[model samples]
Target: MKDIKDINKATVKNKTVPTTTGGGVKKVIYTLSTIQRIGLRNSAKALTSHNACKACGLGMGGQRGGMTNELDEFPSVCNKSIQAQSTDIQPAIPNALFNKHPLLDFQELSGQEIEHLGRLGTPIYKAKDSQHYCEVSWQEALDRIAKAMRKTPAQRSFFYSSGRSSNEAGFVLQLLARMYGTNNINNCSYYCHQATGVALTNTIGSGTATVSLEDLNGCDVLFLIGANPASNHPRFIHKLKALRERGGKVIVINPAKEPGLVRFAVPKSAKSLLFGGTEIASLYIQPSIGSDIALFKGIAKAIIEMEAITEDFIHEHTKGYDNFLTNINATEWQEIVECSGISREQIGDIAKIYAESSNTIFAWGMGITHHTHGVENVEYISNLALLRGMVGRPGAGLLPLRGHSNVQGIGTIGVKPVLPQDVFDGIEKNFNITLPSEKGMDTLACLEAAYDNSIDFALLMGGNLYAASPDQQWTKKAMDNINFKVFLTTTLNQGHVNGMDNSEALVLPVTARDEEWQATTQESMFNYVRLSDGGIKRLDHVRPESVILTHIAEQVLPDSQLDFSAFRTHNNIREAIASTIPGMEKLAEIGTSKEEFHISGRLVHDYNFNTQDGQASFITHSILRDEREKPLPYTLTTVRSEGQFNTIVYEQKDSYRDTDDRWSILMNPATIEKLGITENSCINVRSAHGVMNDVKVFPFDLPNSNIMAYFPEANILVGRDHDPRSLTPAFKSVNVDIEVVERQPSLSTS
Candidate 1:
C-alpha cells in the first residue's frame, strides 16, 4: 500500500478556492468537459433519451423528457446523471482485455480503473483450472450456467439483483427463481435500505416513502438526517434551495460537518452560482456515530416538555403513544448528551424548530441504516414524525433517501428472499404454478451458506456483490466456496476479478437501460414509476437483461409450468407484473400509454395505514449504553466521496473535502492533537475484521474520537456484525485503533 502524504496540502494554503459550495461553476465546467470527452452528439442523445435518470432515485427523466424531473421541471440533470450516461455510451471493451491480462492483474486495478476499461460487449468464462477469462459464445455460457443450476438443488442456488435493472427484468428474474423451486431471491436493498423497509413496515405498515415528490413543495421544515444529499443526490439541492427561499427551514444532522450540506450553489440557477450560493442548513447538528437513537429520543423529550405533541392526532391515528411517551420521558438529558455528543441546548433548539413547523418531512440515508441498531434508528425517526402528526399527511412523512435509481422498484417487484402471502398467491395464481414453500436466505445468509459450501450456484444481476458487501476478504472467500457463479453486468468491477477466485465464473454482457431495445420501467424513491423508451443497442452481442434472463429460464426449466418464452418482451413481462405485483396494474398499459404512475397504497395522504387496524403504531427502543464501549481508539465510519457512487470510484479526489486521495483517513484537528499525530501522517488502521496499512491521516471538521474513510476500499475493516432486525451491516460505526507508521515533514507555506 502506497502512502499519500499531504493530499490536501496545496488546497489548505489556497485561500481563494472555495470548497464549501457544491455544484457551482465547477459543476458546469465538469459537465462540459464530460460532454466534450464523450462527444457532444453522443452525450446529447443519451441525455435526451426517454429513460429514467440512472443515478439517484430522485425520479428524473421519462416521458416528460430526459432532462426533466417527476415534477416536470426542465434541466434536472446532475453530475451523477452525466457520469452514468458517459459510462454507458463508451465503446465496447476490447477482446484483448481478457486475453492479455491475467485474473491477478485485474485484481490490482482500482474500481475507477476497471470501469474505465469500457463496457462488456461479449460473454466471457473462466474454468476452475484457468487463470484467465476467455471470450465464449452466449449459447455456451448460458448452457453452462443452466447445467450447473439444473444439477444443483434449488435451495442451493441464490439470485441477486442490483438497482440498475428495470422493473421488468427484476420481475422476470425473481419469478423465474421462485418457479425453479427456490425462494433464494434477494436484491442489493438487503445491504443498503433493508433497515428502512423493515422499520417502516413495522411502524407505518409501509416499507417505502410515504410522501411523493409534489409533497416536498408543501413542507415547511425538512429534517435532513444522516444523509449528505449534496454529493449523493445533487438534484435534491434544488428542492432544498427552493424550500429555503420559501422561508422553510432545513435542519441537517450528521456526524461530519459536510461543506456541501452547509451551503450549495444550484447549477441551474444563475443567481445561486454567481452569488456565494444558497444556504442549505439553517441548523447543522453533529452527533456521534451510532448515537442517533439517543438524539431522536432527546428531541422527542424536548417536544413533549414543550407541549408540542399533537394529542388529538396521536389519540385518533396512532397506538402505543403512552408507552412511547413514557420511554421518551424516562430518557435523561445527561444520557442523551453523553451518548449523542450534542449539547442539551442544541437538541432543544432543533426540537423547537420542529415544533414550530406545521408541515415537516423527516429524511435520512445509509448513515442511519448502516448500523447494528439500524432498524431502531429508522423507527425512532418515524416516532419523531408521529409525535407531531407528521406522517400520513400532506408534506409530512418519512423519506428514506434510496441511493439507487431502481432499488425500491426491484423490491416492489418481489426480488426478496421471502415474499408476502399476497405476492406468493399472486405469483401462483397468475403463473398457474405452485411456488416454493421453503424459507429463503437474504444476501448475507446466502454468503454465509456459500462459505459453508452449502450453496453451489449464485447469479448476480447488475451490481458488484463483492465490493458492495462488508468484509471484502470474507465475501471473496464465501464466493470461492460456490462451485459456479454468473454475473450479468455492463462493465467489470472488483467483483468480476476478486470474487471469482476458486469458482468457475461466467460474465455475461448485458445492455444498459439506455441501450435496451425494448421499453422498460423504473420506480422512483417517491413510489412513482417512470417508463424508459430504451434506444438502440451500443453493442450487437449485448442483450437486454430481461431477454437474457428469460432465455436462461427457458433453457433451465424447459418443462416447467411457467411460460418463460412469454416474458421475452418487456411488455409481456410488464403485463405479468401488472397481474401479480400490487399497484403495478398501470404497467400493463404503460408501453402504449407512456404514462408514469405511483404505486397504490404506498403514499400516505390520509391517516389510514396498511396495518391490520388501519392505524400507524409508535415503536420505542432502549438506547444501548454499550455503544460507548471504547475498545478501540476511534469510531470509524465509511463514506462515499463526491466523485464516487456507491462502490464505484469515478474520481479519487474528493473536491468537497479538498482531498485528492481516497486511501486516507479524515479526523478532527482536536483528535489529531490528542493523538499526537500530524496531518498526512501514515498510519495503520486496525479493526476487528481486518487492517488497512499506509493510510494517510488528514485533518477534517469532525467530532473528536470520530473519523471517516472512503467505502469499499475501507470496507475491509468492517465486520459481518449487522442489525438483528434488518440484517444491515454496521458500516457507519466500527471501532478502530490507529498506529502511526510514518510522519511526513510539515508543508512549507512561503
Candidate 2:
C-alpha cells in the first residue's frame, strides 16, 4: 500500500495541465483503488449483486432487482457505485474509539480523516454540558428523544430529508411530520432542484422529465446544458456514447469546459476504454456563469430571424407566442451579447443546429438553477424548445437532471411544506387525521426560523445540512439555536460536530439501503421506479430509518390518530403511498408483485399536458444585472470534486480536475499571471458571506473573469442570495474578491 506521504507527493504528478473531461483510465484506477481500500472481498456482493447505484439520480441497476441496469445486463455498474457501496459496507467504528477521541479531538480532524473513521457503529448522545458523546441503549435514546420532542410544539419542529432515502421511508417520515400537526416538512431539494420543479411545472404542467429513458435513446439531438455528467454522473456517459453511436448530436453548454463531455473513455466497452474515448460534444458553448437566460434568448432571436420556427406546432400546442416574439424582437443585440458573453453569429449557428434536428432534448443541472434568475433560465430554455417544437415528442422534451438518487421520489411522496389537496384528502380519509393547514417553512426558512429561536426541534433523515448549506457561519449559528437536533444517518459527517446550536444532540445510526430487512423503492430522473431487496446489514446495533422513525413516532405521538405500529411493515407504507399519492398507484402492489414500474401522468409523450388548459405556456422573464456594492474581480462558483458524492468525501483528491488539495481554487493561467499570483500561492477569498484564507490557487481553463472552488469548503463564501421564486441558493454566481497571500511552509519532517 502506498504511504500517505507518497500519495501527497504523487499529487504534483497527478495534477493535469488541463483537467481530463470525464471517465477514462483515471476513473478505472480510482475505482479499483477504493474497492481495494475497503477490501474487494467485503465489497464483492455490493458490486456484483442486484442493487441501485446510490451515486446519482440516473437510476442504473438490474431492472428486476439484481446489480444490473434496466437492460438486465450483468456487471452494468460504474466506478461511482463501487466507491459508494464499498465505503458504506466498511466495518463499523467500535464504541471505544468514540471514547478515545473526544468531541474536540474529532472536531480538530480534517474532513478526509473524519470520513476515514469508518461507519458509525452504534447510537450516541451528547448532553447539554457534555464535552464528549457517550454510547447509549436504543431504548434510552428513544426515550430521551421523545421527551425532548414532546416539550416542543409541532409548529416549532421541522423535518429535513436528503435524496438518498427510499420512497417508503420519505413517505412515512413526512406523514409522521404532518400527522404531528405541522406542515414544516421539507427535503434537501430546496437547495438544488427546486427551481427546476417550479419552472417546469409553470411551463409544461409537470416538474419532472417529460421523456423516458427510451426517448433519450431515440433522440437525434440533445442540448445538455449546465450539467457535467462526466464527473458528477458517470453512468450518463454511457447514454451519450449510445446516442453518438446512433449518429446523434450532443451540444454541451457549460462554462468550465469539462474534459469528459468533450471526450470520454467508457469502461463499458473495452475497445473504447483501451484506445481513445468516444467523442461526446459535437459543439460546446461556454457562456458566463448565470447568463444562460441571455444566451437562450439570443438563440430564440436568431431562430426567429432565420424563420426556423415550427409555426404549425406553436399555433396548435402553445400559448403566448405573439408576446414572446414581441419580447424577443424588442430585445437589442448588443444587450444580449454583453450579458451572454457569446457572439450573435455563434448564437445563430446553435439555433441553426436546433432548427434542423427533428428531435432534440433540452436538459440542465444546478448551473441553471443556482441563480437569482434561475426560473427565468428555465423559462428561456423552454421558450427555445417551444419555438423548435422539441417538447412532448417521441424523442425530445425537457429533462432537469437531478443529483440525489431518490430526490424526485421524495417530492412525489409529498416531502414538501404544502401537500396537493387531493393527496391530502386521501391521507386524511385513510389515516383519520386532520393535518395542519398553516404554511410550512422550506430549508432556508427553517434555518432563518431556527436563528430567530422560533424553531425548537429539528429532525434530519439524511444529508449534511450544515456543510451543504451556504454561509457556513450563519448556518452553524442557525442550527445551534434549535433546542434539540436529531440526525438519523449511517455515518458521521461534519454536520454532527459543527452544524448545531442545539443544547442537546442525538445521532442514531441507520442501516444502508441495501441492508434493510424489507424491500424499498427509488425513483430515477426518468420517472422509472426500481425495487431494492435489502438484506445486507453490516452492523448489529444499526437499524433501518423506517424502523427508527416508526419507533420515534410511536413514542412521541401515542395519542395520534394513526397506528404507528402498522408502519413497521414496509409493505403497509407502500400501500398507503400507492393509494394516496397521484400517479403512484402501482407502489401498493410493488411488495407482492416484485415488479419495477414507472409512475404514470409524468411522461408527456403527447401534446396533452397536465395543465388546466391542456396546453404549454410561454413565460417572458427579465435578465439579471451586476447589483454588487463593491464589484469583485471574479465570480466564484462552488462545484463537487470527482472523488465523492454530495457532501460525502470518499477521497480528498478530485481526479478529474487533477487537484489533490481540496482547499485549492481553479483559475485561468493568464489571469493568474496578470495578477502576479504564482502557482501554488495561497490566497484570501472574500465574499459578502465570509472570508477563506490560505486557499491554494491553480491554473485551469475557466472564463476570463471567473474561478471555481470545491463546494462545502467554499460554501462559507456563499450567502443567503437565492432566487426569489424557488429559494434555491445562488451557488454558481457568487461575487468574490481575491488577493494573493504568503505561501505557508510545509510542516512535514521527512
Candidate 3:
C-alpha cells in the first residue's frame, strides 16, 4: 500500500487533443438523408454490451483485473468513455484510470491520472499513508455523526439527501433531523429545480407535471427547454415520440450541443429500437448560457405583439396580466436578440409554432436553474405557458426533467431545510413539539457556517456536498473549521478524501438505487411508493441510510419524545409520513405495486386554486440579466456528459466534445482568441476566495463569453456567498477573469 504522502504525490496526465474544423460539423448536419436515418436505427437496434475494453482494446480479467486496484480504476474509465461519447472525440490517454474509482487528491495528480479524475479534487486529509482510508464500523460512524449534529446550533446544521433513498428511510431521516430542531433540508433539488417547483406551484398552484401519460399525444407542441431527456431521463422519450406521431412540433434550447436533442434511441420500445430513434426535437437552438431569461422573454414579447395571449383565460384565472403586458411592451426586440443570441426570425418561428398549437408542454433541466437569476428564468418559462392557458391543460404544463430518479419524490416525502407552512404546523402538532424558530441552514449557508465556525457539526444523508458545492476550497475550509463532518456514500470521493480535517469526521458506505434498499423507494414518474422485496441482499457490511439514522438517533437522543426505534421498518416511517402529508395517505395500504399513483391535484385541470381567492397569482417579471460579466470573451455553461450523473464519475468520457474528464474548462474558439488564450492554454480561474491553477482549456461552441466548466471542478470556483435565492451556490454563472498560466510539473512520470 502506498503511503498518504506518496499517494498524494501520485501524478496524473491531464492532456489536451487537437480541435476539429467547423466544416466537418456542417457536412454531417447538411447531408441528413432518409436512408441514413434507417441505417442509424438498425445500428442502434443491434447495440449490446461487451466484456472487453470498448475504447483502448484492453482486456478485463485476472492479474490486471484484480479487484483491489480494479475497483479504483472503474470510475476513471467510465468518466473517460462518457466524455468521448458526449463530445464526438477521444482523449489523449485512450481511457481514464484504466478502471479505478474517481476519489483522488487533485493538486498532486499527474497529467495521466488527472485525465481519469474528471474534475480537480485533492484529498487534503487521509487517515494514514498506507491505509489511505480506515473503514469505521457502521455504529461508530453514525454515532459520531449524530453527536456532531446535536452540538451544532441546530440552525447551522445542514442535512443534504439524495434521490436514492427508500421512502421509509427518507421519511425517518427528515423527521429525525427536523425533530432535532432545524429545517435545513438541502436535497439535490436545490441544484436541479427548486426554482421550477416554487415557480410552478405559485403560477399553476401545483409543483408537479400536470400532464399524465395519456396527455402525451394530446399536445400540439413539445417544448424542450433546458432539458435533455434522451440521455438524462430516457424513460420519458416515448411521450415525445407519441406527440410527434400526432403531428406535434417540437422545440429545443440548450447551451451545449447534444446528439440526444437531435436524436434518441429508446432501449425499451421495440418499434423505436427497430426503426432507429425518432427525431425528438424538430428545431434545435444552442443559446448562450444564462440567457434563458432573455430567450423566453423574447418569446413572450412576440406572443403579446402577435395577440397570441388567450384573453378569456387571462381575464378569468389570472391576476397580473396587464402589468406583465406592460413589461413585455417595454422590451426592445434588438436587445432580446442580442442577449439571447437568437435571430428574430427564429424567435418569430417559435412564436408562430406556439400560437398555432392549442396545447404545449414545457420541460427544463439544470440549464435554466444554475444561474444567479435561475428563479426568474423559471418564472418566465411558466409565464409563457400561462399566457396561452397551458398550465392546467391535459397536454400543457411545466416539467423540470430532474436528475437522479426520485429527486422530486424525496422532496415530496421529507427533505427540506424549510418545510412549507402546512407541513411545519403538522409536524409540530403531530410530534407534540415546537421546532426551532431560526431560519434553517441551506447548502451555501452550511458552507458559510463551516468557514465562520458557526456550525460545529454537519450531517450528509446521501450526497457528495463538498464536491458538489461551488468554491471547493470554501466548503473544504468550512468543513475544517467545523468540529466534525459526516458523509453517507457508496464510494470514496473528493469529500471524504479531502474535506475531513479531524479524524472525528467519518464516512459511511451504503447501497445504491439499483439494489434492494431494505425499505420502500419512490420515483417521480412510476411507482409512487415502491416497497423493496429484499430482492438481492447486499454485503452485510452495507446498510440503508434510514437504518443508520435510526440507530444514531437512538444513541444520541436516547430519551427524545419521539419513538425513533420504530424506524427499523421502512413501513413505519411511510405510515408516519402518510399521516401528515395527504399525498402519501395510502402508501401503507398500497405497499409496493406495479401501479404508481399519480400525485393528485384536483384543482390542476379544474382551474380552481388553493391561493387567496381560489386563483393563481402571477409575478410580473421584469427581465433581469447576470450583472457580473468579467469573463467577457465567452460565456460557459457546464453540461454533463451523457454517461455521467451529478458528480458521480461513472465515466471519464464526454462524447459531445470528444474529450475525457480532465477538469478542462471548455470555451468558444472566438472567446479564447479574444482573451489571447491559446487553444490548450493552462489558465488559473481566480475567484473571491482563491484560485484553481493548472486547469486545461478546450474551446467549443457552447455559450460565448461564458465558460462552461464541468461540475465538481467548476463548483470549486463558486463562492459561499453566491447562492442567495435558494443558496444553490451559483454553479451556473460566475464572474471571473481567465489568466493563462504555465502548466504545472507532471506528478506521474517525474
Candidate 4:
C-alpha cells in the first residue's frame, strides 16, 4: 500500500486580490485544478450528470439539466460544485486498505487526509475490543443492526440524518424510526438553521424562504446580515454582481470586513474580467458580535421617527404594529449606540436607505442563527422588512440561506423531532401508520441523552456530529456512551473514526448522489424541488441509500404496516412524500417527467399568509444587553475559510485571508497592539466552555475587541449554550480572553 503522504496533494495558489470579495481568475484556475485532481474523465462524467450540488443549498443542478439552476440557466455551477463533484467521483476505498490501519491510527489523520482515505465502498464492522474494522456482508450487517434494534427500546434508539440525502431517503428513514414507535428523529438543520425556522414561523407563518428566486433578483435593495456569501455561496456573488450592474444597493452587516464582500472581480463579466473588480457592498456596517438586535432596533426607531412607516400595509396586513412601534420608541439612543457599537447617525443613514428603496429583500445565514438570541435576531430582521412592507411582494421577503443542499427538504419531509398535526395526519392517512404523539428529542437533546446513557443505539445518515457540534470534548464523550452506532457515508470522516468508542460501531458505505442508479429529489433554499437522475454506480460493493434504508426497515420491523418494499424505488417514495408533505404534490411525477417545480404555499406573493390569523405578526424582543465585565473582553466568532465547507476542509489555506495555518486566530492590528501582543504571537484563548492553548494570532482587518477563528477548531471553546426557543448553539457569540504564551528556549543539543 502507498503511504498517504506519497500521494501528491493538489497545489492551490492564491493569485487573486488580498482580502477580497468574489469572482476572479483565481476561482476559474482553482476549479480547473480540482477537476484535474479528480481526472478529466471522472469530472466530465459527474458534471454532465443530472445531480444536485452537494456543497450548498442553492440547488445548482438536476434532471431539468446539468449545471443548471431552478431558473434553467446553463452553467449555473461554481467552484463549490466542482469541489464536491470531484470528491464524490473518486474511486472506492478497498478492504485491504482498511486492514492496514486500526481505528486509533485513523485518528491521527487531518481532515484533508481523512477525506482522501478514498470512498467507503462496503459495509465494515468493528467488533467489541477489535482494533480494525472487517468487511461484513449486507445481510449480516442488517441482521446485526436489526437484532440490536429488537433488544433496544425505540425511545432509547435515536435516528439522526444530515442534509445531503435525498427527500426520499430522509422521509423513509424518519418514517421507519416513527413506525418503530419513537419520534427521536432529527436532521442537521437543528444545529444550523433551527433559529430561522422558529423565528420565521412565529412571524410570517412560514419557516422557509418567503420569496422566490425572481423576487430576490428583482429586489432594488438587499440587506445581507450575518452572512458571508462570497466564501460560502460563490455562485451567489454573481447575483450580487448583477444587482450592482442594475444599480441596486447591498448593505452588508458583519463584524469582520471581508474583502470579497466589499469588492469582487466577476470572471463571467467581460468588463469585470478585464478591468478592476466590481463593488459589492454599497454600505458596510461592522457591529460588535451579538449586537445585531441593538443595531436593528436603532434602525427601526430611526425609521419610525422619520415617519416612514407603511401605514396601510401595516394596518391591513400585520398585527402588533403599535406595540412594536412603542417598544422601538422606548429604546434609547445611548443604549442602542453602546450596545450595537455603531453611531446613532449611521443607524439613521441605514434606515434612510431602507426607507427610500421601494423594493427590498432581507437575507441572513448561520451568523444570525448561531447565537443565544438567534431566534430573536431573525425576528428583528423580519421586523425591519415588515416596517417597509418588503415581504409578500414581487421584489421583497425574508431568505435564510441554508447551508446544506437539501436541509430544507429534509425538514419538509418530516425529518423532525415533532411533526405538525396536518403533516402527522397526512402521514397516518397516506401510509396507514399511527405514529407516536410524544415529542421527540432534537439533535442537542440526543447528545444529552447519550451522555446520560439513556440512548442505546444511534444511526447517523450523514454529517460529522463530532466536529460540527459545539464543545468537541462533550460531544465525543456523549457519543462514546452510546452502545452501538452506525454511520452511512460516502467517504471517511471524523465521525466514523472517533464518534463512537464501542466495538459494535458499523460503517455502511453508500453511493453518492451522482453515483446512484435511481432518481431522487432535493429541495432548494427558494422552496424549489429538483429531480436528480442518478448515473452509473461508481463502486461494485456500494448500494443506493434508499435500498440500504429499506432493507434496514424490513429487518427491524418484520411486519411493518407500511410496505417497506414499495419504498425500495425512488418514485414510490416520492409518491408517499407528495401525499404527506404539503406543497410537494408535484414530486409524485417528478422522477418520470424530469420536471423542476417550486413548493407551493411557501413563497409569499400575496397578502394571505400561512399563519393562523392569515396575517404577518410582529415578533418583539428586547435588546440583549451584555452585562459581563471581563479583563479578557474580546468576543470570538467562528468563521469558515473560502476553501472549506461545513466541517470539511478541502484546502488548508484560506485563499482570501492569506493564511495556511488553520489554528491561528484572526484579529485587528489595533486590537493586537492594545493587548500588548504582536503578529504571530502564541496566545491562550480562554472561553467559558474551554480553553484553546498556545494558538497563534494573526493581524487582519476586523472590528475592534473582536477576534475570528476557524470553525470545528474553535468549536471546542464554544459552550453548548443555546437559544431556549430554538436549540441552535451559540457558536457565533463566544466571549474569550487572550493570554500571551511565553516562548521556551531551544534544547542545549540544538
Best by TM-score: 1
- Candidate with more favorable, higher lDDT: 3 or 4: 4
Error of 4 at 571 (Å): 1.3
- Encode model 1's per-residue lDDT on 373-445: one tens digit a residue: 9999999999999999999889989999998999999999999988988988998888788988999998999
Candidate 3 local lDDT, 1-750, one digit each (tens): 022110001111223322221112222232233114334442222111111111111111111221111222321122222222221111122122322322343335432233243221111122422223444455556555666666666766667787655566677778777777777777777766777677766776766666654555578898888766655554356567667777888898877655556655444345655565567778788777777777888898888889988888889988887888888788888778887788888988889999988888887777777777777777788788888888766766666676654676677876877777777787778779777666776666667777887776667766567667766766777776766666665544555556554434665655443334553546443213333343233344556677778887887677788888887876677667767775666665544532335455522565676566766666676546463244444344556654455665544555545555557777666556655665557887766545568787765556566676666666656665443564454666666667778543332323
TM-scores for every candidate against the unseen true structure: 0.97, 0.95, 0.79, 0.96
User: What's the CA error at residue 472 for candidate 4, in Å?
Assistant: 0.6
| Model 1 lowest lDDT segment of ten | 1-10
The Cα local distance difference test for each model comes to 0.88, 0.83, 0.59, 0.84
Residue-wise lDDT of candidate 4 within 1-750, one digit each (tens)?
Answer: 246531112211211214544667888888989998989988877887778878898777787566887777677888888878766777777688678888777877878778887888789998767778888998889888888888999999899989999898999899989999899999999888999999999998999998877776898899989999888987787888888889999999998888788878776777886775789998999998889899999999998999998989899999988889888888789989988889988998898889899888888999899988898999999999998888888888999988899999999999999998899999999777788988899999999999888999898998888899999888888888888888899988887878655637888988888877788888989998887788767788888778988898888897989889889988888888888888889998888787788898999888888888899998777787552232358898999998888988888888777667888888876666666665667889888788888887766677788899999889889988888999989899888988879543322222
Task: Give the Å shift of residue 139 in candidate 3.
Answer: 4.3
Which 10 successive residues of model 4 have the least lDDT summed? 6-15
Candidate 2 C-alpha lDDT tens digits along 1-750? 111111111222223255464677767887788788878776786665556678788887633544566666555667778767866876777787766655667766666667667788888988877766789999998999899888989999999899999888898889889888788999989999899889888998888998887788878889999888887888777888888989988998888877788888997688778777889998888888777878888888899999999998899999988999988899898888988788988888788888889999988899889888788888878888889888887899998889988999999999999888899999988888788899998999999998898998889998889889999999889887888889998878888888542368899999888888888889999998988877886788889889999999999899987898898899999999988999999988888787887789999888988899988988986566752222777888899887778888867877666676998888876667666666688898999889988988877667777889998899999989889999999988899988778643432224
**For model 3, the run of ten residues with the poorest summed lDDT:** 3-12
| Model 2 lDDT, full chain set | 0.83
